[model samples]
Target: MKLNSPSRIHMGLIDLNGELGRVDGGVGVALDYPNFQIEGKESSEIEIDFRIEIDEKDKENLESRIKNAAKNVLDIIGETGISLKVNDAILSHSGLGSGTQVSLSTGKITSLVYGIDLNAETLAKITGRGGTSGIGVAAFETGGFIVDGGHTFGEGKDKIDFRPSSASKDVKPSPVLFRHDFDWDIVLTIPKGEQVCGDREVDIFRKFCPVPTEDVQKICRLVLMKMMPAVIEKDFDSFGKVVNELQNLGFKRAEVGLQKESLKGLLSKLQEVSYSGISSFGPTIYSLGDKDTITEISNEFFDKFGIEGEIISTKANNSGYEIIK
Candidate 1:
């Protein structure tokens, strides 16, 4: 079987003050490139192979995710083993939500191999993802501009709680509050810098979470009044304005402030000409508006810094993931 999953860019985190009993609301969009692609078939025992070009250190991590997903499915279905291979992969921990895409893709592939058809939500839960944000899972299932309502905050210890997806043990993927066929060209700027992931990500969350209530309110207004209507009406100017400000509120504000100085300067420069924002705990900056303008600025940035990056212009994926037999 063959499988292809879209890469996700977390546009912004809406609310972090879940201590007040609301889930962590977030927004993001799916990208068409730098995707997780896998082609695998049944084998005697469970194993995974990778066609890697970016880095070799990722080999073990890639293998482990696939192995863990296979184990979870086998435990439930009573299957002895299965084989898998990753023909391609997304960049890990670049604030692209690579982990979720890879994990869910592996689960989807394995379940098909074992004759168990699982939904993206099930794949997400069983593989231990989508705890905090559903955009990644929903984007993988169906490529679009998506906003998730977030998980519910309940009373019981075992009930839903506000926590990072990585920390949460088991939880249902958040429901999609809204989804739309986003019609706009996007410019991606990936700079050479540190990525927020693993323990470092957890630390950042611990320190900056319970983000200010005022910022969260601003984000809600932008999403509800400005962002949604702009996309619906195909008004790029209004859309770009909201997209530019998405990182100004909640946890994403901290993410932008915490960027490396050079990256910060680069983002500032891009903002001068384009409506832009950082994606999640990003080193990947995405800009909307005139594609040509963003590309020109990004090119000049790379030339001046002498830094190499895989910067490209792409569009939104309007459909869901594909599974080919």
Candidate 2:
């Protein structure tokens, strides 16, 4: 049997440095991409196929991670009888949510093959893929401009409370735009290298972050009041400014090695040319501008850097993913 799934790009609005007792929140938008397909299914065994390009170092770990995630999905849905052969790749990493997309596609295929009644939120939890940044899971479950409520954080003893209490509960994600007629284009610049945000980095950054209660409250207020509303209105200028400011502030509080150097340089250049905002974690820099501007800027950046990267332009997918059989 063969199955098909949809893929998406994540618009980096906020950084994820402060998600779980760290510093602030990571805000992002989900851009729908025309990539995703799952083929071959059987009662005893299944084969998964997907195409995505990322840094070579992450390839091995990514493959294993996805396979485990797929197995987790099957186990959570009570379909442990099936064995999976997952063949996955990352087409674009820095800007697109390739990792999350792969897990979602895998989970969706497993549900279809096994006859499971898992909803979007339930599936997201089962996969254990999109809790830190829910935008990726939102895009996989429902493609479009999604504003996730973000995860809660706690101290050492309170860590257990942070886990999702009800995995099966439906989370109605807010749509950034209602009509979906916004004219926008994104140019993703991923430096040719591997940038890892592992457990060590997270711990180091968390240790350095300020512990004042007022600071966290202020960041939350800005996210709810200023950032979210601007995105809903499709005001690119205000949105870009607020997002950049938020990331810059968070970066200051973060440790020195949290973000990669190449990503920082690319972001500097993109900001000079007036794109939108940069990616949160590592080397993926997303520049948002009109078609003409995006094209011209992308060409100039590629020519100057002399590196091979992907440049894709797409609109907000308000309609989400559809089954085309």
Best by lDDT: 1
- Reference-based TM-score of each model: 0.95, 0.73
Q: Taking the tens digit of each residue's C-alpha lDDT, what string does model 1 give over 231-317?
A: 889989998888777767788888999988778888888888888888888889998768778888888888888877768788887
Model 1, global lDDT = 0.81
**lDDT of all the models against the reference?**
0.81, 0.52
TM-score of 2: 0.73
Residue 183 deviation, candidate 1, in Å?
A: 1.2
Q: What is the lDDT of residue 141 in candidate 2?
A: 60
Reference-based lDDT, residue 208, model 1: 88
lDDT of 2 by residue, 119-236 (tens): 5566666665554456666666655555555443456421222222112123222222222233455555555655434554355444654334554555566666766676668777
Off by over 4 Å in 1: 157-162
